[model samples]
Target chain A: MELWFSEDFSGGSRFGARVTQVVASHKSEFQQIDILATEVFGKMLVIDGKVQACEMDEFVYHEMLTHPALLSHPNPRKVLVAGGGDGGTVRECLKHSCVQEVTLVEIDRMVIELCQTHMPGLASRLSEDSRVRVAPDDASKIIQQARNMDVILVDSSDPVGPSEALFQPEFFQELHTALSEDGITCLQAGSPFLGPEQVVKMALDLKKFFPVVHLLTIPVPSYPGGTWCLALASKADWNPRGDSGQLIRQRFQDRGLTDQTKYLTKDMLGPCFEVPAFLMSIFRREQQAVAR
Target chain B: MELWFSEDFSGGSRFGARVTQVVASHKSEFQQIDILATEVFGKMLVIDGKVQACEMDEFVYHEMLTHPALLSHPNPRKVLVAGGGDGGTVRECLKHSCVQEVTLVEIDRMVIELCQTHMPGLASRLSEDSRVRVAPDDASKIIQQARNMDVILVDSSDPVGPSEALFQPEFFQELHTALSEDGITCLQAGSPFLGPEQVVKMALDLKKFFPVVHLLTIPVPSYPGGTWCLALASKADWNPRGDSGQLIRQRFQDRGLTDQTKYLTKDMLGPCFEVPAFLMSIFRREQQAVAR
Candidate 1:
């Protein structure tokens, strides 16, 4: 018999790898977490039956999530990652020389524990890094405390269960209040194909606080739709697209990221702002519907 | 029992939507074909057990296939499509009023007939369009006839089964010999992730004949590797990146394609050239191993 592990997306579609071995499986208080040794994706982390990250392609999502926000900010020293238990986001954040402190607030501690045991490259830094701090707590509450952050990266899952609160407008308001005056926060919005309305709504929610809101579409093949969005909101009046993103390019090169980065480069900043045409059409249709 | 239709990639990974109904299933001399009503992707066309196009996201794949090549060419009046049984490519090609004739050569006539019966939006143009000429013939043989196509799009499946011949180096020579001196040809060159080595080798093969060969990455969520590569080759000395693809923008405006296209925009021309980070790294590693 063939062993196939498929995650049912919205009870509609499913995508998963054939498992040679189920490395780890547990039912935490919050969700179900599993580590699978697969043939295609090296080692995959699954939470609540949703594929979180794979060893081979995790760099793409992590680098895309962190570098653009960090580089766009003039100085990103204190970074807060919400729901990134795998520690990939923290690892990317720690790449920047300016980043002095990183606080990872995940809803589930079992996720970090599993990663540290099974996936060393992703979770080892969460423990060994001197500048890092791990807080196994709810992110919305943490953001409500209004601790100033230079950058906040919402590395949450799809808008369901624990992550549903993260997509609400109230959570967005908290994120805005928690960030510094000139700060930038980028969060993983839902898939445009899977939840276009929610994706648009989440972006609109951010607009309630920040004048500058840009949705960067990044390819995450393991995810349900493979293409997902990262909503970047900034309190500053500055535009990310200014000077054809020369600032991002200059900063990326000056920071010696060209040699270090696997996926993101100085050349990629321009395309980061492009929304897929279908998504644009969805926005246009919704504009006729939504007042904002 | 719940029915699931998955296309296994290299027998290592799989991606599929749950089948609500089997609309059409046939075994032609060329390959197996199944039309499925899926819960997530709507009506999906499957060939040789591989998902080809879905009612929902086929636009993303078809638009990406047709627009860039047609727009980049000085005046793409005559176009040739190889192995595009689902008439989506023809629909996209005919969208350009400049195109005078479209010749669709396919190895399997049954696939076209099946699509014509079920997928009206995708296949109706084949029977109705005045300019479109549906040729139930081998694409390789058709290309060998030196058709002098201004733009040639190979809308074939993965380099396997009947579509295998379309990916050979000799086939690249035939494609070059068939095109005009200033012609532009774009072909789906398999997934960068599923078959990175094949992707690199295919791009290199195109370089043997054309001075300008670019690999454009597009997302097709239904496909095994949601992200795939399109190799666009040009006989002319011009780069598509000239003036940030201002030509495409001007042509889009002049041609009034701004109102018609769902996916490819003038703004997307810059990104049409941006290779995914992992793919770029793969290319770098391959360059170290393969000599020109």
Candidate 2:
């Protein structure tokens, strides 16, 4: 007998992986989570029937999500990760030597526990790092008290159900309030091809609170669309394209984190911000709407 | 009842689209071709059980494959499209005002005929354009006698079975001889993530014939691995990054092709060449092998 795991995107498109067996399945108060061992993608994590991450390409997502924003800030000492129950964001955050503390606020303790047990490659650092702290609470509420944060990484799921509040305008406003003067915030923006309107909506909302707002795309095979996006917002003028190569290399060297990364590099800083013409048009239309 | 079409990538990963109905299915002299009207992707062309192009994201593939090489050349008057039976490449090449003639050499006549009837949106220009000349023959044989071509776009399928000859060292050498002194040749190099060795092998082979060989990647949803790469080779010092903004805009204006394009633009030329660091490392290793 052959078993398969599939996820349907916004349209009628679907992606599937051949599964060997279901490792774990549980329904937390928030969502349904399933862990499966797959033939191609190794261990797979599915949340509410959506493939969150697979072992094959999870590094691309975790590296891209954490590195760019963290490197942009001059010194990201106090980092707050919201909704990253997988612990990949915290693992990446702990890589930086300048990072003194990493506060992970996840509403579901079950996600953290399950991931720590099943997906050790991603969640191992959560338990190993002395500087890491886990808070089982709502991310939006936690951000209210998160002051003096140098970097805030909202590694949340899609904007639906419990995670919808994370993408709201009020949450963005609270994120701005929580950040230090020169801090930066990074959040997962949906695929431009799959959910163009949703991505544009988030960018427009971020524009209200941030002086510098940039969108970057990376290829994540497990995602709905092959291409996934990230939105970085900062109080100061922080352009990812303007990232200094020498400084990035020096930081990596100082942290002893040069060989640990699989995808993130100083050379990728500029290219990641190259939004295609179709996506650029979406942003242009949003700008026109604001002008009107 | 529901119908579905699926394609498997290198690492046992698969993508499926729900089909409304199968429009056409035939076995030509070369390969099995199927055309389906998908629920979301509209008309999809499948060759040998592999999804060649879907109506939804075909523009992204055709536009990215043709425009970059054509725009980089000083004067692309004569163009050759090999194995583009669906006629999407011919359609894009016809958009350039400077392109006086487009010679499309396809191995399968049935693929063209069915596409012309079923996928009119893609193959319409092949019959309508006086500049296009269709030759139902093997691309390898046709290129042997070809000469003085400004741009040669090998819009062939994967390097397997009937299309395997397109990626041979001799085919690349013929492509080099057939090009004008300052001409450019673009061919679909397989996905770096899925078929890394295949991509590396092709890059190394092309390095021997062309003075300048560059690889660019685009998000092609229909193709295997989601992110597909194109290898562009030139005899002259034709750097896509060196393409001037004024020239691209002027060409667009003179051609009266500004609004018709969905993806290609002047800004995309430079960033497209900005390959990821992971891919750069592969090239680096190949270079080290060459050095040794």
Candidate 3:
């Protein structure tokens, strides 16, 4: 008999993998965190029974989450990441020399400790840098302390428990206040296939603050859905997927990050902004309903 | 108690869903076929214990498979679909008013019969049209019988059992022989994450017979890995994702298929061809080593 880890979705669908060993399991003040070694995904970090990050594919999620916003921003010196205990987002943010400071406001410190202990590849960046600070406090409160942040990334988990507040309109209002006039906000918006309505709702909420909002689809196989949607919002004329490949390449070269990336490329920038045709019509219908 | 249908991948990963009801189970001469009413996917067709097509997301796969090949062609009048018993590919083929005739060559008549019965949304277009001819025969043999075809779509399962031959050089050679000078060939290449080497291997083999070979990724969340690949091969000076959105939209209008598509869109055509940056480097490394 083989050991397995499975999570059932609202649609009664499941995404799971076989486990080889249970590295560590801890009950934090907020949620349960576990470290498991898996056959394919390598060291797996599980928080509240959800797979947070695995060695095999964290690059795709982390790269998509971090690089798009950072690379597209004109000068991202001050960064605020809410609830990415895995530190993958911070690791990508640290790649940019333009980033002078990073404030990681995660409510669960136990989750960060476990990731640092096991998933060092993702979680080690914060400790090595002098510019980084870990708040380990509730983001809704800590976000108020952040003012004029050049880039704000909400790497929160699903909209449940501690994260439910992060999805509310009040939080969007806070994020808007925390950012500079030209600041950009990017977050894991949800699955377009599973909950396009929720994604649209989040985008509409952000639209109340930001002038430009774009939803991007990234391949995150470990998620309940095979793909995840990310929303990019900004007050300036910042286009996520509108840049040409040559322009994107120039940004990478100018930033000295051409070869530093593993997943993001000049070709990937524009393509991700495309809403699939099936979802395009769905998005229009939802937006129209919300508009009324 | 909940009844679940689980399939384990070679990488120790699993993708399964709860079954509301197992509508039909048949052991055909070639493989085991199952029609299941799934909670989220609506109805699903499983072959050899692998999730083949589900009603909820089949449009993404079929539209990506059919429209790109049909639209890019200057004039796709004679279309040949190899192993698409689900008729989703056939249905998409019929959408193009440019396609005067479509030959659906599926080996399993039972699979076709089952699909026609249970997945009418995917399989009903055949009987409704006089242009379609159902050839329930082996693809390797039937492919040789076809010539001067404008477009050939291979809607095959995993390269195992009955579909294994579809990935061979001999079959690709036959596809080369059975095409008009400008004929294009598109097939369901394997998962880029799971079997990228196989995708590259098939593309390299086709490069022997065709001047251009492009592998495009499609989102098929029902599959183990949320995404799958499709390879486009042509002897003419053709490109799968080289055209602009305006050009792709023009193709749709010219073919009179603007309103017929559910997933394929002007914006979607170029994006799917972006070999993700991680996969892009791997593809190049493989191609360079092969070049030596």
Candidate 4:
């Protein structure tokens, strides 16, 4: 018998993978989580029926999510990762030698435990790194108390259920307060194709708190629309594209982080900021609406 | 009762869309063509069980495929579209007022007839434009006989079945012969994520004839890896990035082609040439291999 794990990625589109075996399944206080061994994506991590990360292409998503934000900041000493329980974000964060303290505020300890046990490649860094701190609590509450964060990476799921609050303006305002003077915040904005309005809203909301706001895109096939957006909002001017190739290459060399990356690189910095014309139009329209 | 259309996108992955209704299905002399009204992607056109075009995000693929090459050339008057039976590529080609003639060399007439009838938005331009000439024949043979073409867009399927010859080195050589002195050719080089070797092979093969070969990426959700690559090969020393903003804007104004495009814009010209680092590494590796 053939078993397939299918995700209904809204608008009646479904992406499915042949499941070899169910590795782990559990229902935590917040959401249901499952880890399945898939024929294509290798070990798959599913939370609330949504594919969070798969072994095959997880590096692309993780590297893109973490490195760009980390590298943008001159010295990301104290990094705070909100809502990344699987430790993939933390793993990428630890790659930087300048990152002295890595604090991961996860709502559920179950996700961290499960992933650490099942997906060691992603979650092993959680326990191995002496500088890492895994806080088993609400990110919204944690951000309120947290201060002096050099870089904040909101590695959350889609804006639904628990993550819905994370997308609100209040949450962003609190995040703004928690950040240091030169700190930059990178959050997973929804797909421009599937959820244009949502991405526009996020960009608009982010612009209110931070002076420099930019949307970078990367292809994550497991995601709803294949293309995913990352919103970089900074108190200080941090244009990723403005970084010189020599500086970026030197920084990568300094951190000893070149070999660890699969997708994120100094060369990719310029292209990542290249938003499609259609998506740019959406942002323009939103700005016009706000201006009116 | 519910119906669905699924394509196994190789590497043990499957993408399925809920079928609202079947628009058209036929077996031409070339391949099996199917048009279905999909819940997510609007109308989807499938050839040989592979998705060639879909209504919803077709503009992204079509615009990315055509514009970069067209805009790179100083003045592109004669454009040849090989294997774009659906006419989507032809529609994009017509957007540039500078394009005086567009000859579509398709292998099957049935694919055009079906798309023209069922998918009018894409195929209607074939009949509406007086400059378009549909030649229902083999692209390989047609390309060899043709000459003085400013831009040649190969909108063929995967390097399989009838479209396999289009990826051959000999075919590329013939395409080189057909082009004008400062001509450019843009072909859909498969996804770098799913089939890196195939993309590398294509890039290496194209480099044999063309002096300047560049690979650009766009997020195409319907395609195999979600992210698709387009290879731009030019005989001239034209770099898409080197084009000034004023020049691009002026060119857009000259052509009166600003409103028709949903994705391509003057601003996107620079970023399109910024390839992913992983892909750049592949090209570097291939170059080293060739050097040895």
DockQ of 1: 0.68
> What are the per-residue Cα lDDT tens digits for candidate 3 across B52-119?
89998999889988887776678889999999899999998988877899999999999999999999
Residue A175, candidate 3: how far off, in angstroms? Answer: 0.4
Cα TM-score of candidate 4: 0.94
Error of 2 at A84 (Å): 1.6
How displaced is residue B291 in candidate 3, in Å?
2.7
lDDT of 1 at B60: 83
Interface RMSD of 4: 1.9
TM-score of chain A of 3: 0.96
Model 2, position A72: C-alpha lDDT score: 78
Model 1's TM-score against the true structure: 0.97
Which pairs clash in model 2? Answer: none
- Evaluated against the true structure, the overall lDDT of model 4 is 0.86
Pairs that collide, model 3: none
TM-score (0 to 1) for chain B of model 3: 0.96
**DockQ, cand. 4:** 0.61
TM-score of each: 0.97, 0.93, 0.97, 0.94
Sorting all predicted structures by DockQ, with the top scorer first, yields 3, 1, 4, 2
Q: Residues B1-292, candidate 1, lDDT per residue (tens digit)?
A: 7998877888887787888999999999988999999888999999878888899889988988898888888789999999989999999999898999999998899999999999998999998989999899989998999567899999998777888899999999999999998898999888777787888888988888999988888777787667778888988876665762778768878777886877676788777788866678877887777764
Query: On lDDT, who's better, 2 or 4?
Result: 4
lDDT for residue B175 in candidate 1, whole number 0-100: 92
How does residue B246 of candidate 3 score in lDDT? 52
